[model samples]
Target: MLLEIAIGDAYGAGFEFCGREKIMRSNTLESYVPHELGIQAGCYTDDTQMSIAVAEVLLANSDYSSDAFADAYVRCYKRDQRQGYAKGLQGLLDLCVNGADLRQRISPESRRNGAAMRSVPLGLIADKNVLAQAASEQAMVTHNTAEGILSSHVVALMSHALLYDKAKLVELPDFILEITGFILRGDWAAEVECDALQTLHAVNTALQANRCMSTLLLDCVNFGGDVDSVAAIAMGLASLTPEYVVDIPASLVNGLEAGKFGSSYLRKLDVALAGRYPVLSAHLVRQS
Candidate 1:
């Protein structure tokens, strides 16, 4: 899931906010493109970095808490400050001393897509009820809004459905309605930047699809604003869509940055996460 998040983030990194007209002209998905951060071809942005933070917290034997999530996010952000975090958040990351300070300082209730973007790790928990509580806790660490929490819940639950019971995904609009008591209406326009509702709709649409990772990712970028995040959040769960690398382009994986927290790290995290859970549908995945 983390690996797929990085791939999708990196895949859409090149075209973030370029809008529909500019991205369509490229007409190709064969290789990594230049990222807005001016990083190397396949180096991911804050999406994968913060996701690694969430994964590490889950990897820990200690209990999950907002302090822990905040600390992990701060550590990851400090490790790579120039990785294209949002301007408003970049300032917050600098002043806050630790996790405790972050929670207090992040007073402005943001409904941005960050909550949903880093939420891929929450789906690893098999129990749906427990997962929902944890998802709210993690999202409230920064994005403490009704919309923010709801979007996180939707992505985590949908990811769980994709992994455990894909058929339940068809019931997403209903499941969200049933669980959150929130009605999901249609008529969402594209160009989804940091908006929680729009991104949730996009992730749900991507998960509702059983498309190959290649097509899923390309289609995500075509959705326009904040394309990288939509792709990252969608691909993290859908990465386990049973297609594996056979359906995924080799270049997307091989071409990822080989830094300390790059593709190799993501692969190890996936292996460790799967070891801690029952991956019923992924028995055929390539270990290598």
Candidate 2:
């Protein structure tokens, strides 16, 4: 799931700011291409970096800790500040590193998709109930808005469903709708345009068309705003099946920048995670 998140983010990195028409002009997103970051073709953005941080902290502590997660996020940011983080996240990290309490210093107005982008790790590591709590905790570290927190929850739930309910893959659209509807009836009902709802609607529409994995990814990217995060979430959900996992091109995996966490980190994390969870081990073995 983590590897799929990174691969999807990197694959959509080049099209982050491009409109659907612009992407259409390019024909197909067969491989990596340079984007505004001016980095290598398959270099991931802050999405994958923060995700790895979350996974590392969870593995080390064996549970969720907002402070530890915040510290890890700050560490990752300092390691590579140019990973296309939103202005709000950069400011939050700055305050955190300077001794401010992240929970109190967070900007509640920041409803960006960053929270959702790094949430796959939480979903993979926790059970259904714990997943929601951890997703909320980690997301509120920077994005304190209800919409932001809920967006991460939706992604976490989708990831959990993908991992444990592989047989019911076709029911994902209905599940997403039910979840989003419940969210809208809550205290954050005013946040109708939240990223979670938008992404769910997009996914539901795409699934209704019964498109292939490549087309689904490309459509997510071509949706334009917050493309990388949306594509990453879409990719994580799509990767539940062996077919979609194999559909991910080798070039994107090969092109990712080998930073502190080298290319092998994905395989290493997979082994470690599977070892820790027998259910995950079964899922991975079947996928393999």
Candidate 3:
């Protein structure tokens, strides 16, 4: 799922903020597109980086507390902080040294998709109940709003349910709403913005409308604003589905940026997480 997020993030980086008409015209599926931010093709952004931070916290600490979440995110952000973070977040990342600093300075009302994007790995925890709590906590460290927190929970829980065969694709949106009580309605054809609800709706819409991972991701990017975030969420979830898993092309799997915390590192982390989670052992599709 983390690997899939990076693929979608890198794939959509180029067309982010480009209107639906333009994106539909280009329809740059099956490969990475060149980003205006000058990010190299197949290189992911802050979306995947912060997700790695959350995954790192989970891997290192059994507690998954707020402090560990904050520290891991700060450490990950500081390593190489140039992967398309929003300007306001860039400033916050600059000032925060640790969990204490993060607690003192982090905004409580910010409702962005950052939390949802990073909440992917929370689904790997064996205990679904514990996973739900960790999911909310992980989002609270960054985006601390009802929508922000619930959006993360939805993403994380959806991942868990799908991975464990607790839910099916057709019933996913209803199941999420039933559990989280966060109803988000939107047109996938419309512009998807930075708002947590809108982004989640767009991603959900795209996921339900398309079975092919490539088409689902295309639906996400075509929505325009915050394209990478929507695509990242959509593709991450789609990768878990048996039908969609094979639809992802090899170019994305092989073409992602390589180095520390890059393609190879994500694969290693996936293996390590699967070793502990066991549930993930049979579905290690990052190498597939």
Candidate 4:
């Protein structure tokens, strides 16, 4: 789970964040960039940033508290202007700023990508039940819509399983199906106003290669809408089965700038994980 978060953070910072300049680039150029630059340079989007927010909340409480989670979110949004925050998240922050009932204010009205992006952190910090609660509360605060909450909730619960439940990763499809089945059975599935289904469908198909990172990139990008969220989920899946993640490409791992955006903090995380589990560092070193 920790390793997954680190990779998600790296991808978020490397690819998603840097791609902002691409809006002005030619369509042809835009198409060529990802393949040329690779996913390593692909920074994370609102997804990883929100995950960071969740992690901050967990660190403070060592558990999931809806109130504390909401507070941390507001703080993260305000602190990181470059968090790739969108309007939906901004609204949640607004409600938080106004001291609104976060649980009630955030409802099924939001069918946006906000929920799925940040939910991964909760997945890592808590168990499935707590993860589901955190995802639901966070979603309800701004995205009252059923799809919105499901998007985040399903992914968060899956992430939790991936990180803590070793048995789950071995049967990836069953795990994804478990979450999807819950979403399908939930009230959120009744309100099908958004393209979230498309994203979920894509995710379902992509999980077939549930053991391969390259397969995730293909499925995530090619599967169409909500590539960032799709990729984020894929990252969660891949993190669950790191044995299949392969080594980080030399080019992507080499030119990383480690002095910015608490890059050192990320390294510290890496060191901690490595020290506690020498095999991880050994794997990384071998990959290097």
Which candidate achieves the best lDDT against the true structure?
3
RMSD (Å) per prediction: 2.5, 4.4, 2.0, 6.7
lDDT of 1 by residue, 1-288 (tens): 788889889888888886466687762677888854575568788888888888888878646677888999888877766566787787999987778877787774898988889887787778898888888888888889998888888877767766776544456578667777766544344778689888887766665554577787877887788888988987886665554333667887789888778888888888888777656227326434
Which scores greater on lDDT, model 3 or model 4? 3
Tell me which residue pairs clash in candidate 1: none
Q: Which residue pairs of candidate 3 clash? A: none
Write down the TM-score of every candidate. 0.90, 0.82, 0.92, 0.67
C-alpha lDDT values of all predictions: 0.76, 0.65, 0.79, 0.51
lDDT (Cα, tens digit) per residue for candidate 2, span 1-288: 667677777777777766557577652666777775574677777888888888777677655756777777878777666656666666767656632365567655666676777887676754667777788778877777887788788777766766766635566546656765532211111211226556545544443343356676766666666667766766666665543534545566677667666557765776777676544665456334
Shift of residue 251 alpha carbon in model 3, Å: 2.9
The local lDDT score (0 to 100) that residue 288 gets in candidate 1 is 43
User: Model 3: per-residue lDDT, tens digit, 184-254?
Assistant: 46355678788888888898888878888877777787778898988888887776767564466777778
